[model samples]
Structures are given as C-alpha cells and as structure tokens.
Target chain A: MSHGRPVRRRGRPASAERNAGEPATRDRILGSARTEFAERGYDKASIRAIARGAGVDSALVHHYFGTKEQVFAAAVQGAFAPAMGIPDLLLSGDREEWGERLVGYIFKIWEDAVTRDPLLAIMRSAVSNETAAAIFRGLISRNLLERVSAGLDRPDAALRVELALAQLVGTAMLRYVIKVEPIASAPAEELIPRLAPVVQRHLTG
Target chain B: MSHGRPVRRRGRPASAERNAGEPATRDRILGSARTEFAERGYDKASIRAIARGAGVDSALVHHYFGTKEQVFAAAVQGAFAPAMGIPDLLLSGDREEWGERLVGYIFKIWEDAVTRDPLLAIMRSAVSNETAAAIFRGLISRNLLERVSAGLDRPDAALRVELALAQLVGTAMLRYVIKVEPIASAPAEELIPRLAPVVQRHLTG
Candidate 1:
C-alpha cells in the first residue's frame, strides 16, 4: 500500500502508466507530466521535467512509463476520465434539452477544482504538443466521440458528434486555456441552459 | 492537419497563403510557405520542401524569411492577419438574430475552397504542433483577438471575445479539420443562420 511504488494491473491496456490507485506514484507522475507538458509542450517535456514536477527520480518515470509519449497518453485519458460518463448520463433520458445538459456538464467539470487545473493542462498540452495532441485525438475519438456519436439517431450523427465536440471544447478552450473572463467565471448553472440547446442541436435536435 | 486548404487575414490581414490578387514570386513563396508549413507543420516543414512546393529555390525561403522561426512567424502573420469587422456586421443594431448572422459569416469563410483549406491546416497545426501553435498564438493575440474584443459593451467583453472566438474556431475545426459531414458539406447559406445567433450573443447580444 506504499504510494511510492505503484503496481500495474495485469492484462490491462498497455498505454500510459497503469493507474495503480488514487494518488499513486504513477498518477502523481502523470499529473505532473500533464502540467509540465501543458506549460512547455512535447519537445520541451522531458522525463526529468516530469519527474521534477512529480518529486520522483527520472528513472522512476521510465520504470513506470516507458516514454514521455506514453506518459502524455495517460495524462489525456486521465483528463477526461471525469466525463467518461457523459454519454451514459446523456443517453439515459429522452432527446429533449440534451444540448443544455451536455454544455452544463462540461462547464461544471471545467469548474471543479480537483479536475479543472489538470484537465486544462491536458487540454493545452493536447493542442500545444505533438505527442500529446495525438494522444488527445485518439483518446477523444475513441472514447467520447465514438460513444456519444453512437447514441445519436441523426443521419448525420457523426457530424453532430464533431459539432458538439467543437462547441464544448471551444468553450473549454476559451474559458480555461485562454482564461477568458465571464464565461470563465460565470456560474456553471447559468452557462448550462444557454449552452445546452447548442449542444442539443448537435446531439438530438 | 491534412494540407488541403488556402488562407485568411484581419480588417483582413494580407496573407501568405494566396497571391490571388498578385502573382509575384514573393507572394507565391509566402503562399507556398503557408501550405507547406500548415500541412507539414513548422518542424516537418523544411526550407527545401517549401521551395519544392512553391517551385522556388530553398535559398529563396532563407532569403525572404531568414530562418525557420522567421519564416514561421511570417507565414502565421500572413495567414491569420487581422481583417475588417464581422462584429461590425453583427453589431449593426437591435441585433435580435445576431447569432444566426454571426455563425453564417464564419461558416462562409470555411466553406470556400479558396480560404477554408489553408486555414484548416494552420489551425490544426497551431494546436498539435509546437512551433506552429506558437505562431498561431502570436497571430491571434496580436492581430485577431484585440479586434474581436474591441467595441464589445458586455460586462465581460474579453470573455465574450474568447467565447466568440471559440464559437467561430470550433465551427471551423469541426467542419473542416475533422470533416464532420453535413457541417462540412452543408451549403454555407444553410449553416450560417444556425450559427450566427450564437456568435451574435458572444458579440453584442
């Protein structure tokens, strides 16, 4: 149960460091890597850099995760882990107000203290770094895009998925990455209603 | 990311993506740099490669731009230069259906073969590639953002600027980069009304 070392789950996916437990060294390393990459980008993101942020030895980073790219992938997957339930939360109900609900949900997550900083870091890294962006693209396309698109009945369901993504991600980018005011600080509840219909149009409307 | 498009500006900034109005070699080199840089990104985009694409000598790229960073800086500024007023178009008066108007205007830009493709490459590059992203950030912060944020009467004018940008950029990304179907192929006229209001709200509302 020592947090210094984390055990990887056997027979699990071989991607970013295996999430041994909450706050395990692996998670810690990934978290630090997320911040470093966001701030500096891929070419500048190094094992030593991540380790320094994580307060661990550079060798430990290698031992836990094979490469910086692998670490990046892990960070990205972690970023959206909070919203993995979006499709389920969304599809559980009828088609009405889906957009409002979705936009609100993203805004809420973006506002959460625990998730906000790291998630924004992942987002910036995803766009600002090569390996990180690829990781983000894959993670998003496979996880959110596919699952959400699957729930839509529109002839252009796939297109809708992309639109919805643009709406939500664009909002997040402005609100978080760029730190635009108002939208960044406006109550999440206020945002949800205004933003949801937009999301709904992309989803079911 | 896919290297298929053309170019853009402020009040409309003069761009390197097209020599449409002029056929000068300098213009052609700038245009070629835009495509090559946009497609392959700053790192992968070599002087030699740009020369090939532009049908010029590698020495010429070095001659005009000086170095890759200078070349990248030039390409970015030329591609995303400031343009005339869209908000002016939207903020005409009483702007009840502003959202519809705003969305449509932005969409029109992305739908045209002459403009959409190079923008597609620049945007994708800005997010996923380091040097290009830096160039994009500079272009946006320097030229586009200030103009967009100007003249807003909202309590959160800056936030509105970010949101407005998010809306426009998001629409473009989904429609062009991701090629999200109907949004991509949909008639520009058809898509504008749906989008303008959201943009309108971000602006004057």
Candidate 2:
C-alpha cells in the first residue's frame, strides 16, 4: 500500500473529496487485492502487503477500511461489481424470458475475461476463509439471489433464486477446480439455454 | 483426530507401537490443526502453533504432510470423513430412490452428533481457504456428484444433480453459518420429506 492520505472519504459523503481516493485508491487496493487474494488467499494477504501493493501505508489501509474483514468485504464486492449489474439486464424483458435472461447473464459474467479472474479469486478464497467466506456468501445472497428474487412473482422466488445461483456456482466449481471435461470448457451460451429453464422454474414456477 | 488408529483398521499400524508416545502426539497435532484451521482458517493456521499444541517437532508435521496445503487436506479429510460414505449409500439402494435416499442420508448425517462436527468444520473452512475449498469442491464432484450421476435416469441428471446439491449446500451453509431461523434446527425426517422431491427431479425427472 504505497499511496497515503490521512482520511478516507471513500465514496461516502458524496459531496466531498472524501470521495477522492474512494475511486482511485480504493480501486487500486481492490485490483491488487484481487490478484493477491487469488494467488495467496486471505490468510496470506496481509494488510502490509496490500498496503505495499497499493503504494500506501498500512495505516492508510486501515483508515480507509476499518479492519481486515472490512477490506475483504470491499474487495469481494468490487470483484463482482461488473456482474452485479446483470440483474437490470435480466429484468428488462417479459417474465417468460427471465430464465434465459438470468442464466445467460451469469454465464456471460464468468465467460468474460475482465471480470473472471476477480470472481474466481473470490470464489476460491471464500470457501476457505471465514471472514472472506461470510462476505462472499453474503455478496452472492444479497446481490445475485436477493436482486433476482425481487423480479420473480412466485412465493418461493427467494429459494429459487438461491437454487439458480447454486447451479451457476456449482457448475463453476466443477469446471474450474475439479477440471471436469466437457463441462469445463463448454461455452457458457451452450449451458444457458439448458440451465435457464431450471433457473426459471426456481424463479417463476 | 484423537481416538487413535484408523477406524477400519483392526489393530494399530506398525508405526503406532514403534514410538509409544507417537499416536498421542500425532492425534494432538491433528486436533490442533483442525481447530486452528477452523478458527484462523487454512491460510492463517500457523504450523508454529500447531507444533506447540501437539508438543512435537513441527518438522514432523511437514515430514508427514509435506506442506501447509497437505496439512490442510489431511485435516479436512479427517474432518470430512463421515461424508465420503455418501457415495456408497447412493449406490446401494434401487436407483429410482437414489435422490430421496441421498437427501435423507445427508440430512441424517448432519443430524447425528458424530458426523456433524467435521462436516460443519469443513463447510465453514472450505469457504475461506483455497486448498480447503478445492478439497471440499473436489470431494463433492469426485465422490458425491459422480455417484449421484451414476444412479440417475435423466439425460441431464448430471446438471440436475449439480443443481440439487447446490440447494443442499446453500441450505447447509445458512443453517451452520448464519443459523437462519427454524430452517437451521428443523428435524431431518421433516426436512428430508420436503426437500427430497426437488432432489428427485434432479436425479430422475
């Protein structure tokens, strides 16, 4: 963490410079943290190392984020920031297409290069670290599951949302970690049409 | 970790009596490793402390497990041993009832005191550590998912099994981690009847 400043107005109090480093320094930490956490994971990603990566003091890292746990929360959130917008795309059309829309949106996010690494890092790290695990699970439940649930008309929409996300998550785990063939390298688009109906069932049926 | 000797072995392995204090020493180290991995998680659990807890040479641990990664794997497998039997159970009954049988078995395992601890430890720790995450994910795909697929009658049973397991895993995560409402404490028989059909659709639908 090479960069340094006394106070962090990090995107809070939108009217001030407090929002200053919120963008650059925060993004800097997030990017580096993404790589570091992915490479070494939570136990190895020390505050000092993250600080060094950001060209900022460790104190500044703490000032911006209250604790290591908070920093992790921010990192996981930033990693998924790109895909977090997918719900809007999903909710845009008729409810019938919702299944395709939701599944396609998720497959696209993992398929794309820019967002893939960070998400993989989050996925890899969260299952092993308690703090990161909590944040990662929460991010999925809140951002993906809860957001998707809001668009569904069914009573079990929330459970369905979780079930759908689970499909994506479980498939990703098999494809990436277990190195399962066929499923691993198969195109996301190919999987979407097949899985969407099931997701849709969870969502509307 | 403590009740020395492999569960299936009729007598202590030759190495057990070679050094009278060794089994106690090994078990202690394994126990400490489990707790450390659980609390600090995989990346954070230090060999130094694990050595102190075991009252043996830290070098001995490295000699046995090779690295932190190996240590984590050993600990998780030991902790998660109860679940490995899932594959066997799924394969035992009539194939048509595999889904219900599998779900009921998992619920029962979680309900029982003996099999519960290691699973809970693995579930929580798997989310936060990479190696543990990999181990957890691998154990599922290799040991659990393959078995589920073998007994399924549907063309997409592979995907469906993945889907069904996702719900179970997510539900387990919430039950163990967040302790979410009555869902966490619900009896196995009651919960299985409700959840098994969803799994049945995944297996044979």
Candidate 3:
C-alpha cells in the first residue's frame, strides 16, 4: 500500500510533471517535524529547521503543514491514532480482563521505541506549553476517556476511566519520562500483574 | 514557625553585630530556588535570578547554597519535606484505611494554593529537564517508596508502592496539571473514595 497519502493517489502523475518531487514529501516533512519538536520542544521548535531537516524548502513546509500549531496537530494525530483504539480494546474481551488488557496494551507501546519516543516528546512538550498540553488533553479526553465512558452504564464512568488512566500515565511519567528506578528497570511482565488489579478495581470496584 | 527556616533561630541574636541579616538567609535562598525551578525549570533557571528573587546577591546564593545543583538539592529537600511524612501517615493508619488517608492527604496538598503552586511548578520542570526529573525521582524513591516499603511485610512491595503512587500522581497530573474535564472539576471528596480502592489494591492485592 502507498504511504503518507491519506488521500487517494489515483490520478497517476497529473501534477507530478510540474511537481516532480518525492512520493511522500508530506511524510518526510512529518518525520522532520517529529524530530524537531521532540528535540527542541514546541516553544523552541522552528519550521525552517524542520524543512531543512526534511531536505525541503521552508515554503514547502508551510504549504504542506501551514502553521507550527497545525504541524503539531498533524504530528499529534499521527502519534496518537493508535491510542484512539484503546476504547475498542477495553470494550472487547471479558470485562473482567479489561484492566489487564488495558495496562498490557499500554506497556506494549511504551516498550517499543518507535511509538514511545514520539509519545515521550509530546508528553515533555505538553508539560512546558499550554497549547501542547491542550492538544494532549483534548486527544485523551475525546478519544479515550469519552469513548470508554460511553460503553459504561454508570454515571461516574468518566471519573473512573480517568483514575484508571492516571495510574497508567503516572507510571509512564515516572518509569519512562523521569526514569525512576525500580519501576523504570522492572520487567513489564512483573508490573502488569501487580498493577492490573488496581486498574481493574478502578474500572469495576 | 520561623518562616523559611529549616533550622531554629536561637541565642537571642548572640552574634547580631557580625551577622545582622535575617536568621534564615539559607532558607530564603532555598525558597527562591523552589520558585525559580518551578517557574523556569532547571535549564532556564539561573543562580542570579534565584538570588534576585530572594533579595540577595549572586555571591550570597553561591555562598549559602554552593552550586546551582546544591541549591536544587536543598530546594528539593524543603519542597518534599511534607510529602516525606507520607510513610509515617501510611504506617500509622489502619492498613486498610491507608489508601483513603493517602489519597486524602494528597488532595489536601493539591487543593491548597500555598503548596500546590510550587509543587506544580516543580512537576512541570521535572517533566522537561533530566536534572529536575532526577531530583524528583531520587526524592520519591529514597523518601517515600523505600521508607514505605520498609514498613511492608510483602515482597514486590516497592513495585506496589510505585503503582499506588502512579495512580495518585497520574490523577494529579491530569486533574491539577492537565485539568481534564470531570476529574478536573470533580470534588476531591468524590475522587478520593473512588481512587482509594485502586491504591489499596496496589498496596495489598
């Protein structure tokens, strides 16, 4: 399958005659932006630098992603798209194992460098910038908490979901972001069993 | 309480002629560092700025606190002193009620402006800077987790303690820092009961 083209590439090279550029220029810009944002953070990150990193002109970066905020939005969308599937994951399977599955799925991502690095960058940016934090908040709330709550019949389901998430997010912040010992070095399998019940209790208890 | 002092001011100005400045100049520098670190984070925060914030010269700051790192160490000790009381609180309470007490104490600090503001600043700083994060991690591990684990009879106790903390810290990060809906707006009383069980399970289950 062709990549980086969220839109159909049906019309062959109609524009390619004029634009004879790489196939996934947008993806390249995205890749560069991710590196820039992760390294420099939102406030210090620059479009010029991102374009340079992507081996493109600054104008192209602007044309493709518009403002830095828009670029950040796109980056967030790409990074968090899989996490949006969390509600479905939580909804399926026995309700009894939802907590374990939820935590399990999260650690799976955290353990993988490709996914974890961008996430850590976003998390660090959010801590420093209100705009970044707002984006993080909106994504988590709309995609995960709200979706998960919709499946529950209870009134406090939203709060419960957040509490459960707090556990996971907090652990991630400590273990991954802060590199806190024990938790940081402990095997994920050991933690999964120990922490899953706490998550489960949040969901059902 | 003599404000800003970690030590007592005794002797009725025995050496007032030679050292007439306030008795707690050291404490004052520490207080200023906390504000600086919290507001600007570790990288951006400066010794001169912290000194100015405390109404002292840079030399005085250096004289009293040594390196910026030392200032941060002192600031951490001061800022985290209250939280260090957690083990005592956890140990004294009915083991079952420890969760409730733990959550209650945390919410008390998070809800209070005097404490919450500085703590929030420190947390935000810690998220972005490795030095700040290291200070935070060291304090939690040495003061809270290890101390609490010492009280526990069970194995994996340290991991359990970290998990319980993850729940509390994550909730605070989202509710107080990220300010997500429902959990952000929900009364602490409401959250405490719901979150207590999750913490309990991490500690005991």
Candidate 4:
C-alpha cells in the first residue's frame, strides 16, 4: 500500500516516517475519519477504526491527528475547505454585497455533489451527537464567525454572525439534508435574490 | 394498568374497545410515542415499544395511531402545539410587528425547558435521519409555511416564507440544539430585536 515508501510499524510519529512534504498519507487518514464519523457517528468513531479503514497502523493515525477530536476537526476543515475561506470571501468584495456573495457561494456548494457529500456527513453527525456538534460549532467560530465579527466593528457581532449563519445553515438543512420541497426544488437564482437581502440585514442592519 | 378502562388485547381493534370522545387513551398513547421517538429516534421507535411505554397494549397504540408515521405526526403536533397557531398569532397582532412576535414566541419555546426538550429531540433526529427529516419538513410546510404564504399575497410568497422560517429554525438549531455560544446565552430581548426585522422583511419586503 505504501508503494515502496518506508512503512513505520506502531508508535512512531507519522510525520517522521512519511516522505517529507507528502500530505497524501494525512489526506488518506482524514478521508477514513470522515467515513468513520459519518457511518458510526462521533461517539462510536474511534481512531483505531479510522486507521483500519485507511489501511494504516492505529499509532500512525494517532501520530498524525493526536486525538479523535483533532481528527474530527481535520475532517470538518477538509469537508468545508471550499467555504473555509468565507472570511476572505466576505472581505474581498464590498461589505454591502456580503449577503449576495455569501449566499451565492454557499448555494453553489450545496448544489454540487462532490462538495455537498462531506458537508452532509458532518452535518448529520453534528446534529446527532454533542461531540460532533461542538466540533462543528468550533469550526464555524474559528473559520467564519470570529473573522466576520472582526470585520463588522459592531456591537453584538457574535450574535449577529450566528443569526445570519443560522439562516443559511437552516436553509441548507431543509433543502439538502431534509430534502424539503419547494425550497429543495427551487433553482438557486430564485433563492439567492430572496435570501441575500435577509442575510445582508442580519449582518449589516 | 388501564385502571378498569377495558384493556384490549394485542389482536383486537383498539378504538372499538374504548369509549368514544374520551381522548385520555389517545393522549396517553401520544405521550408514550413522544418519549419513544425522542429517545430512540424515528427509525428505531416502534408501536409495540411505545405501547409498552404508555402502559397499554400494542393494539391500542395501533388503534389510536395507525402506524409509526401517524404516531410521529401526532407527537410532532403535540410538541409544537404552542406554535401551531402561528397564522392566528400573526393575524391577532399588528401586522407590522409580525417579526417581533414570531421571533419572541420561538425564543420562548427554545428558552423554556418544558418546550425545548421535544423540539431538541426532533431537531437532532431529523438532522441525522431522512424519515424524521421528511416529517419535520412536512410539518413546517403544512403548519407554518402554508399559513405564512397565504397571508403574503406577494410573488414568490412560498420562497419568502421559507427563508424567514430558515432564519428562525437555524437559530433554534444552533442555540438550542447545538448550543452554540453567544446566541445560545444571550437574553431573548437582545436577539428578538435583531432577528425580528430580518424575518419581517422576508415576509413583507
């Protein structure tokens, strides 16, 4: 499986054993963690199990990620990599148009299969388990909320950021995870216009 | 266990055995179903198990609510009874303050332990399970969306109502279910003012 790359047995740090600058092994471990968390949920997903799924020694999994919580964080970051730059995206354009840009970008992610799958898995696990939810919330706070709040320079920044997020996240839950009708079937063009203003108000007004 | 109210056996029709217009049996069954669904989730909750919880025969559960689906519907209605008359609530107040009223009411439900429990259970189960999610969406469309849309008399009324609902529902998921910070701890007074306008605009703008 290593393709002639030196394979370390148990207890050695993964980074020390792997070829320098090669993230393929780390990526493979994250992939396995994603599947494990999705299938077994947070409480049941174990480092040992994820290592087995990735076809690596359990020690290697620990060496790379340290703990299940860290593994979950890595998986969430990877799953949301497309949207992880939301802070940058929000700051790139006129802040007034933040709503349109934010909604447009999120709608694109939910509409596409490749990006949506990992997000769906993370959302499923998060809703069902407190541990997963903490990780999900942590990702949002660190990657999106804190950054957006910093840019706002307004009172109640945290509350405002969360409320705006709630709107988008809720819509995604209904449209994708729940498969609610109408909103679920409506084309993105129609939704973006209607929802953008609402998001904008939450963020700016 | 039935206290002399003619306990029906497993194979017998439940309604026939009970007195007409007496809803005690029906209410008891619904109560049991709520607990069962909350604890076990939709896919795992069974009529027999619910009957056992309610201290009645399985046939009685089937007789009151035909299937697990119907039982879930009953449980949902009961759990959401406080907010089910949202249309009436909307009409009873000044239409201009609709957003404030709506957000205030929902916030109360999430803040109170009595109302929040079942809702949290439903939200958690729905996010993780497709069956539960479908039921959750159907309830939203029938009870909230249809009524809100009927009052709009605007183009894209359905879409607008859903977006408004998404804001409130998403907030509830984060604050109550996921327990995300700030919004999760902020006083209701602070949030209602901020969120109400957003919802009102979605409805009227």
Model-by-model DockQ, in order: 0.22, 0.23, 0.60, 0.62
Cα lDDT tens digits for candidate 1, A80-115: 798897888777776786776677677677777788
Please give each candidate's TM-score.
0.65, 0.73, 0.86, 0.83
Per-chain TM-score (chain B), model 4:
0.83
* Superior candidate under DockQ, 1 versus 4: 4
Model 3 misplaced stretches (Cα beyond 4 Å): A1-23, B1-28
Report interface Cα RMSD per prediction. 4.4, 4.4, 1.5, 1.7
All candidates' lDDT scores?
0.65, 0.68, 0.81, 0.80
Which one wins by TM-score: 1 or 4? 4
Off by over 4 Å in 1: A1-23, B1-82, B91-101, B111-164, B173-205
B10-86 per-residue lDDT for model 4 (tens digits): 56545545546247778778777877776665666789998998889987677767878888877887787877867
lDDT of 2 by residue, B1-205 (tens): 4587456453333564545535565667777787777666666678887777777677877755668777777776776677777767876778677678878878777777666766666655665555676777666677766766676655665666665665576566555554433445555665566557666665565
What is the per-residue lDDT of model 4 for residues A23-74, given as tens digits with 9 covering 90 to 100? Answer: 7788888888988887666766799999998889888787777889888988
Count of backbone clashes, every candidate in sequence: 30, 22, 0, 0
Q: What fraction of native interface contacts does model 4 preserve?
A: 0.72
Give the distance in Å from residue B183's predicted Cα in candidate 2 to where it truly belongs: 6.1
Count of backbone collisions within predicted model 1? 30
- Model 1 CAPRI quality: incorrect
